[model samples]
Target: MSTGSGAPSAPAPNSHHDTVSDDATATASARGTTPGIAAGPAAPPRKGTFSSLRIRNYRLFATGQMVSNTGTWMQRIAQDWLVLSLTGSSAAVGITTALQFLPMLLFGLYGGVIADRFPKRKLLLLTQSAMGLTGLTLAGLTLSGQVEVWHVYLVALLLGLATVVDNPARQAFVSEMVGQDDLRNAVSLNSANFQSARLIGPAVAGVLITAFGSGWAFLFNGLSFIAPLTGLLMMRTAELHKVDRVPRSKGQLREGLRYVSQRPDLIWPIVLVGFIGTFGFNFPIWLTAFVYHVFHQGAGTYALFNGLMAAGSLIGALLAARRAGSRLRLLVGAAMLFGALEITAALAPSFWLFAALLAPIGMVGLTINVTANSSVQMATDPLMRGRVMSLFMMVFMGGTPLGAPVVGWVTDAFGARIGFLAGGVISLTAAGLIGLVLARVGGLRLKIDLRRGHQHLTFVPRAPGAAAPSGEKALAPAA
Candidate 1:
């Protein structure tokens, strides 16, 4: 649901009173109403990733995003391909990629602060409209056959600036749509939706580029933004959940850094994601180069590689959706597996074999991504979620600006093979280090403790960061 500039009021206790089930348990629970539930006699039936669909507003949001995201992917491929066509320098392509993400590195923290201070739906509306205009500008330049590499760069910067606001608004807005109860499921399904679009977007872009021109792809992307804008406008404002907006302290950005530093569990995952984003996940650079240079193929092959990876990613996202709760085990295990698969794919003998390898690579990578995202989002406080997520996204995406050029240079200097191998090694090494760090900090000594279910967990936080516990006294008890 959408809300205006002001914070939405708390939902009324009698909001769902009319829809009671005709059962004794239901009657008991409905005796006195509450905002989330009637005073329940039993816990609600467990729902999975699709739980968000029960809310009509979120369903509309998802549907519109799926359509728009596909076209966005098309523009991304077209932009990269156009740069490569003009310059033939992987370095130039890397620079363009860097420009697109550079804002996340520089402005991401402040973007988070803005998300906290503003109304997300309104913020999204403005950003989305701006992006649409940027896309239109690209289309006009390209379709008229007057586009230049410099124009592309300038347009990319504009779009990137818009994304700085769009990213945080969208991330924080999800929580407001679906309350905390089904948030993990909503997050998983959202991942699945994105991967599903990934599976379609690039392939379609490839065909469109071959048939008409890159300009048409740009035009399609420009038009696509309308879906999201419409969705935002049409949402029911009253149902939105409001978060208390806190004024920023002078060193709030520094405070965010300190908060991350204090949590080994959170810090390590962010570190691991940063490593992967930097080295392991430069698919734009790798796939395009792999097709043109190594395989001596054209745009079709490039699109095929991305599509196969997305196909794998789709399954991975679904599997994550099937799982009920997030687990640190999933994060570490998936990272190791993703790295191993990436290494194997780099060694594949033929183009088809390498393309086939993308599925597993995509699967493991997506699993790690969704699991890490859900864990971090669930762990953070509502008040600080925007800043924390922004930090997470900055580390995850910003590393690309620093690493893309290096990876591009490596691919050019040594070979694509060496570049892939190096990334895989770094990723695996990161996973191992994170596991060890968790063990050391969480006091995990490989001993069993059945009472608290510490088997899967390596480190447990001593207290709630959001709330202070009551006073306690230490005591000795018989074993």
Candidate 2:
């Protein structure tokens, strides 16, 4: 089933070759292959957020990711717990996290070049195997009572190195599995899968750590790699929709940087994401502080908060799946809402009220995530997808190394409430500034009108020969 550019070219068509199914006929007609057949009506497109699940390859990929994501979250919780148990220092925990993401900031661009030159599937196999080994090594060290802070640090750095490559390859690999037709649905479903795992993994990790120890959680994560590795092996190669591989060449990394720099749509969202990611997405630091300092609670309460957020995130992902397209306005609005909600949660007087607000915070946060991811992917050229997505991931995830320490310092110096307030203020400010920039760059004119006792805001393109608005001009639309 696998067809590549290396495959022998098909023979020229002859009069005798006429076998074709009705579906094939319809496809050919749609493509203008047969002028007579093109006269007929076209078939309807499939609908639903789960439409991507109908693809065998995507089904396998999602199924595997669900299991792997669970283990990933479990290890995340256990790692933090173990570090805290050993040192009782939040700053130590921040350093550990910063180490895990430091490689992405330093080497993520080079990883994109590798992804563009190589086959993603093959590259993933190697990276995933390396990560699994790191997990097993950590598990062994923990179980033997020989795990030192240095050992954890070393393993975290190693895992981050593997992730530098794996993240980009995996992000760009979705196109090959389901093609553009189902890409948005696939991305939303992937988010849902991760969020669902979030709901289960931390809760399970909490139980394991309470009963057996943190060692068991790490051990389980080590074994969880089996599912994804198996799924990769079983995919039908021929069915994959292969994209053109960029030839090995000099300056490719710089070329990617130049490409993104010129495109306002790509760069602006990326900038917003960088700010929000650096400031707003420090959930580990924030959540841990809330549980230990504000609520005076244990690991169980911490797990419950995460579980509630994950539940909200899952719902948001599903709602995103039902939508057909991504919009820049939606991303900006969601970012603003997410920030506002976080501020509200920070000021909540009661524990249950704070927990209640977390659901909406999770919802808006996922909405922004899904919208930005899909919009960027849909806008980029196929040849540049790997590099562009790598840049996006680098900005989104790499910022953690820079921001976590600052947030942790703020928490330690001030209180956890001040930390939340700082994050919210940064998030809201980013959204507002980015919104105005996008409006100006896109030549969009905003109007306010009163209807049914409510004020409505709308954006419209300027008309030709009309008096120009102060800040409006013709500009390219974001794809």
Candidate 3:
């Protein structure tokens, strides 16, 4: 989302790093769509990705979130390692992951309702505090040496319950902070901050896990929550432009479902996200299992791989920030490229070759992510933003809980090679299928409107009287 104070802002704590990674879906919704979407000259001035930071409130929020996100990543590495250590099964790690995200999948629609009904700032305070406490509790149990697998499972489930409400609130809150004008930039910059933290946090976690234990990482993450909470409290609510929360009516959920079903602009991006998410976005499961079991490496290697990917992701996000307008053609093209890159990475024979592939993988993934997000957000009406965004998130993040465990099983049963191959196949298939669906819906016969502004999203069929067949192409005004 917008990681600034009032004019911008925005977790579920699934892992200690849960605070960072899980929130990306919400952040994508916040930025990819809402604000700063416009037609402009190519190559604008070098406004830093963090240009939203020029706003005092947003700067404070971004700084706090950046610090907290680093700690969150540290916790995620530690948590995954701890689970692996305790159960010694990739399946267990996957289950823990599923539990953490299950709430989002099951209750995402309900969560949107909660966000629409509540003031987001106050809601965030509660969720952030609950998440922090969960991390602290896990740390205490682990440090006291009373930790067990069940404890991790329980806490993960609890953190997930909080996420069911928290995720949507945070996504909706970003619109309030930056207004719509700077929302897109703020959102892209926010993703950059997250990936930057990913680049740093995991490498640091690798060192900490190798040197000490998981306990300190959890403790550090628990304490990191204070920074964001303080930032939230310090914000001047009087200056914030809170959105008008409409009272829920009968069949509100169904109405939301119907709203998205009718519009290809909104529905296609979310469906694409689901496909990629289910097949492509199992990095944590794949990477963890590969480094530990396949490559015969340890935590250090795992952290390095993620950090490198984050480096690529940072570059991708920055490039995306420079994109003046959102387009589905660009999104589909990037997704296809991303899937191909992942396939290449999967087939790489050497560890160095595989690691090198992660950079472009990150780049392509971020490109598709930012583009799809901005396209969906900018296209939907403001009244339905929260619900629409939540569904968008459900497709994006919800696929993880459903697919990760299956991917984990495949990796355990077949091999890490097969897992990566399967992921690549799924991603490519999703992109292609979604592209076909969009083309049919938009009545296209191969012509793409990539450079056209967002308003040109509507593509109606040329009428019988509009044109003749042979030599010249028929054109009509966008509805």
If both were scored by TM-score, which would come out higher, candidate 1 or candidate 3?
3
Model 2 superposed RMSD (Cα)? 8.9
Per-residue lDDT of model 1, residues 223-308, tens digit only: 99999899999999888887777585687777667766655446777888988888888888877778878898877777788889
Write candidate 2's Cα lDDT for 1-479 as tens digits.
Answer: 00011111221212111233568556655665432122222322436768888889889988988888898888888888788778766666777888899899999998888888899999989988888888888899999999988888898899999999998899889889988777777888888998999999999999998888888888888888888888899999999997999999998898889877766667888898898888998888888888888998877787888888999999998887777666678888889988898888888899999999888888888888888888777667778878888899899889989998899889878988889889999999999889888776655556688787765976544442222232221112231
Error of 1 at 381 (Å): 0.7
**Collision count of model 2:** 2
- lDDT, candidate 3, 16-66, per-residue tens: 011123354344345442111111113323445566666666676778788
lDDT of each: 0.74, 0.79, 0.73
Q: Can you give the TM-score per candidate against the true fold?
A: 0.84, 0.88, 0.84
Task: Please state the error at residue 47 of candidate 3 in Å.
Answer: 5.9
Question: Roughly what TM-score does model 3 have, to 2 decimal places?
Answer: 0.84
